[model samples]
Target: MHREKALDAGLHPEKIRVEADPYVPIAAARREILEGIVTQLRARGRVPRVCRYALAVGGQEPRHSLDAAAAFAVRQSWRIGVGQSYTDHHGAAESLTRPGWCLVRQQIRAGYADGVVVVTHSVVSPHIDAYKQQLNWFGAHFGFVALVVPEMQEWRP
Candidate 1:
């Protein structure tokens, strides 16, 4: 359906990359994130015997399932030990105040995983200022990196 719509909209089929919607409960998004992280780590010659990772997803409600995310990580040969979801239920919380965000920070601090896999950069907050602050905080506080999966909007398809 998406392919046909893109074709009708004058996008070449070859150029239409059908990416999984990160905002949906799809395992593909998780897989892609894991793959990208692994690739990045490999390029940096930081291959650990086992890739242990934690997941942090942000939204008023979970856009993806933790079980599916874990399974996807396992399928990629990664061991996901922690998973958390953050929500602005009342729409009145800062990025740093989210329980899930705090859990992620704790996991990193405690050395539970090599790094975190965020569903998107917006997992911190939708506001640009908040996002920048969150990124800076992660960089300054944690020695390891936090990898964000590519959002669907990046693809023209």
Candidate 2:
């Protein structure tokens, strides 16, 4: 009904893609296309113009984690932007009140990166809602989160 109404109202048919709606509760076609691009990038090697982000929560050492994330980026064929790596030691807040996180947002805002590579989603947030919120924020900024370690069987696809 709504689709017919939209067409009757002079909306272009191509402009009303129901499957592309974010609130549709299904994997959007656009997302599938993006995943395909990521896969192609991996096949080629060294996808340029990405960034790295790490959170050293609960007193975990940051260097090793960052290196691992960097390796993950390489394996995914992403070339992280120079000086675009960010880190936050204490990850105990939902508000994301950390200097390094703030910097990452800045980089995202400035359109310098497509997304960030992280060790895990838990580095973004331990709670589910908070984790989703962070991802949503990244989406809002036209960026995304790439996890090196998928906790359990949770993969990006």
Candidate 3:
């Protein structure tokens, strides 16, 4: 559908490669988030500091998604010392409240990362209120901010 729209809009297929999957968007979002993080850090007077990353996405195939996200983060000059993905088949709460999040939090508290990069806000919850609440909770408890790529916003601690 998107490829067809691009073609209809006079975009040459040879000039664009389109994949009918979520990975492409996820990867793009990852790059954008990492770059945004770098900019934010620089603005805060942090000079060329290596950033460790934790990747959490909610889906059946989180491994593939996290791999793509991590690759893009590395390309964007993120160190990515820690990375993890969770399958949200059971529920967003189940995944969000699990050990993975705790481990990520631990890493941040231990001075491993400046913040976490979430692929999308929906990874926390589909509902807007829940998403914001969870972001706030993580920020408050972990003392680290989250960059929600899809929303292009940072949920601060």
Candidate 4:
């Protein structure tokens, strides 16, 4: 099914609150979370690990934003597995579900990390429920990290 169809058929979009603060910045929370995830992924190995993070940002400037984010991480000496896949105007994938799943799976494998952290620019949560299903299926087929979205307080380990 097309992304729009899948979403219209009942996919929950991403929900993020864009907090306003003079001391803080937009996407600051997201950047912090991404960096933290990258650090944790790096710590999993005895030696320096190749840390990669994916941002599934929709809209016109995904490449620009993703590149800047990746560059920031790279400056900190991360391996940085990066890629961008554009969604339709309705946040739907023009491609098939299988292909989308494959893209995510390939990225996960290439990163060789235990956990996957997904962030988005849209205030609305995007493709996570659907993405989680795909991740769960991929995990079953490959025996990877048992992906779980923990309760807010429980997310910190």
Superposition error at 62 for model 3 (Å): 2.2
Task: Give me candidate 3's TM-score against the actual structure.
Answer: 0.47
lDDT of 3 at 19: 41
**Off by more than 4 A, model 1:** 1-76, 82-92, 143-157
Q: What are the models' TM-scores?
A: 0.47, 0.64, 0.47, 0.35
TM-score-wise, the better of 1 and 3 is: 3
lDDT per residue, candidate 4, 30-149, as tens digits? 334444555665577622222222334354544443455446444555443434332233344522343443454565566553333322322112443543444344344331321112
Q: Rank the candidates by TM-score, best first.
A: 2, 3, 1, 4
Task: For candidate 1, give the lDDT.
Answer: 0.48
Instruction: Tell me the tens digit of each residue's lDDT in model 2 across 73-152.
Output: 78866778779788777644653787777787788789777677777666777666666677677767666677676544
- The whole-model C-alpha lDDT of candidate 4 against the native structure comes to 0.38
Better of 2 and 4 by TM-score: 2
Residues forming the 10-long window of minimal summed lDDT in candidate 3: 47-56
lDDT preference between candidates 3 and 4, better one: 3
In model 3, the runs with Cα more than 4 Å from the true position are 1-40, 43-61, 82-96, 137-149, 152-157
The list of candidate 2 runs beyond 4 A from truth reads: 1-48, 57-61, 154-157
Top-lDDT structure, candidate number: 2
